[model samples]
Target: MPVTSVTTDTEALTLTVVADFPVPVERLWGAFADPRKLERFWGPPGYPATFDRYELRPGGIAHYWMTSPEGERFYGRWDFSEIEEPDRIVVLDSFADAEGEIDTSVPSGRMTLLFESTATGSRLTAVSESPTLEALEQVLAMGQAEGMREAFGQLDVVLAELREYALGKGTVTEVLDDTHVRITRAFEAPRHLLWRAHTEPELMRKWLLGPGGWEMTACENDFVVGGSYRNAWAPVGDTVGEPFGFDGENLVIDPERRIVTTERMTGAPFPANVNDLSFDEDGGITLLTLIISFPDVAQRDMVLATGMTTGMEASYQRLESEILASV
Candidate 1:
């Protein structure tokens, strides 16, 4: 993680966060100056932010919202008070409603962001000052520190151009928290086609086979909200593994944009895990992000230890070569 420290001073009614990045001060500053790049990592792993309005000049206002896994949106606004090129930015931050109306029920704070050159690259110091110590404590109790850590962890991909950073990196997995794991992979294909490859049974049978010597025997997909899907695989002639399958229900679906499902081994006794998958396309390439929420930390670790990452990479490679190539 880029964030090195997060400190809170009750007497001073301030919270400070310091993060170091391997990019220059200007480049790091551009991440915030540009709304597109800023939204890419503005929220934590599962929640994604969308900037509806962004004006960086002094006295301007920026409105944004982060959509939760269950489709709930939380709105926020920033009132710019000062800006000093690549060095400093001061804003008043507060909660807002869907219509961008300030929510007075929540405490607002003054935030100052400082950018400076570091030995390695650049450092960002963000300080948030509350009107009262109680307000500072309230914000900390809402997981502000941990949320910033997770949000900063996503900056590397944003700082580096998406394609330049992600393309050809078969499958990368990061443990966001004890129960949440995020997996990402980039494909040289359009977003809609990639969505079809995952939803259509015939197309899925061609590449969803995790490893060699196995064939997808049965694929039944309802492909709708509240729909259930079942997939089974059996080893071919010389394969050593036994037959296994999985069943899942679709919790949310948004065509080529997102899909949330609860999956579990067909007959296993363990609880089902929620898989939140999202797709982003740029310049003919699509980036697939899947965030899995396990029932507990034990379940998350156990699944990861089963060579899931390697298997997924193999499957993705097959997907690109077999299903996507002929399309």
Candidate 2:
């Protein structure tokens, strides 16, 4: 949750994102100045970026592309207009074609990134200004805000030189806002096996159990787009808890990379929550990120108050200790 706030101003025709990191201004600036470091977090989870060309000086241009899980490449270019070392950078961002040519069909915008010192570490303020309000709205509708948040969330991994940032952290939950919550966990397992642990009923039954007192009674899954899945659990032996389950429909499935689903409690009297889950792997370690969008603030708060994060941590720990260890 590096991003503190993401706001839009229709009158100003701008979208702004402010994030704080636990590193010095120079360290934070270097992440963007270096193409290699920037590639690690330039795109949202599951969409990794590759920089073909990078020039950090004023009037220089950068060419990059992000590859989707489906192997689709989306290109982008940045024309640097200003560069003030460790302080500010201004660029014209544009959509590009395969040949790195700007695609004027879609609107391009001017972006300004400001780096400043904070008591804890440093702060980054990024503003993208569109020429028209319609252009701003179009970008927002394309999930720009959520994409920016997810991209920034990956910075912690890149900034940690020792690569021990999330090692043994169990599970971390961040409340992004009134209706959105992001959960992250890392495991010493390959991405494909981690995907299998989630898609295969047999593997899921082994570790999806929340706490020690409960056991998964049934596990059913249709791991494909537009497919349905249901999972149930009940207390074991003398444990005093009723059976509970969740049912969801898969909205998008990107094989071992990502999954988006609409989930709801078995008999809850509320709207479904949209869950966007993504997996990113480095070496043999896999990072699992789940962003849940609740119907409203009340529903979000209710779920959190139920010790949801604690229960998830227990399940994730079991996953690592039992399933991952065996692998």
Candidate 3:
């Protein structure tokens, strides 16, 4: 099952495979450098790979074997030529024998993967070249293009699992002072970018979507301390649920450093809560602390028992992949 388009051009002597992921480029690029990540998605669908030896650098080689559905093994090798971090990689792809030797009887492909940052997501273009047009055709006839498409589809699974905890979550939900429920997450983007994502309306609408088949219909924000903000969302199509709304008044605004706001839900049984977002910077990274405070212990416990943490983590994931990555 090809995830996207796999195009071949004999005139240009190249086979190009393209995929667009909502995640950041760094997340996609990590797959090539880490052997474990590489093994997760290098093979076509229904065939999982196991790495025999992996050395991802200039003049190094990656040797792996993909186990077929019927337990058969297909060995492959990548002889690296150039290694660029988070942007490009050049490898000589070939079939390998049982002992990891290149099978010279088959054609080899000089593949170049270029990762381009798009306005909404990241686009990956993989071009495989050959010494001659005949050699390129030889590999094309061997199903290289289709194999790549399937492999890219599997790559989607790997990225999804990784992005679920995009910041490598600390895994500890702190209950500070027994009133403020604080959830801290480290993001790969800058603090200013993270701030902009939360403060700006258009960017906020993309990631703050509540549940599936729901869309944010209105987002109004007044960043000043005495100002107010209102955001409304409704289910799309024939979704069977009532619309949700969040109306809050800004209590504190400290630019990228901190923000405190009160939230009142116009639907459901949840009580009003005050949210404080504090952003910290570490080089190009951002550490955000989100504290949601309720009126009393019963309210906090009720919210926690309702599995709010899981939903919060999921929303943070979208914020990182969709909003910050695009920025």
Best by lDDT: 1
Candidate 3 local distance difference test against the native: 0.76
Candidate 3: stretches off by over 4 Å: 1-3, 162-327
Which TM-score value belongs to model 3?
Answer: 0.49
Task: Arrange candidates, best lDDT first.
Answer: 1, 2, 3
Q: Give the lDDT of residue 86 in candidate 3.
A: 80
Screening candidate 1 with a backbone cut-off below 3 angstroms (N, C-alpha, C), the clashing residue pairs are: none
CA RMSD per model (angstroms):
2.5, 5.3, 18.7
- Whole-model Cα lDDT per candidate? 0.89, 0.86, 0.76
lDDT of 2 by residue, 7-37 (tens): 9999999889999999999999999998867
* lDDT tens digits by residue: candidate 1, 1-327: 788998888888988889899889999999999887788788887777889899999999999998777667889999999999999999999989988888998899999999999999999998989998888888889887777777877887777666787898789999878999989999988999999998888898999999899999999978888889999999999999989999999877767778888899989999999999988776677889999999899999999999999999999999988888888
lDDT of 1 at 277: 93
lDDT per residue for candidate 3 within 201-318, as digits (tens), equals 8788888874567789889987787798899989999888778788888876767766778888866566678886667554455667676878888888877796767756777878
As for candidate 3, its clashing pairs are none
Off by over 4 Å in 1: 162-164, 190-193, 280-285
Q: Which ten contiguous residues of candidate 2 have the minimum total lDDT?
A: 158-167
Judge candidate 1 against the unseen true structure and give its global Cα lDDT, from 0 to 1: 0.89
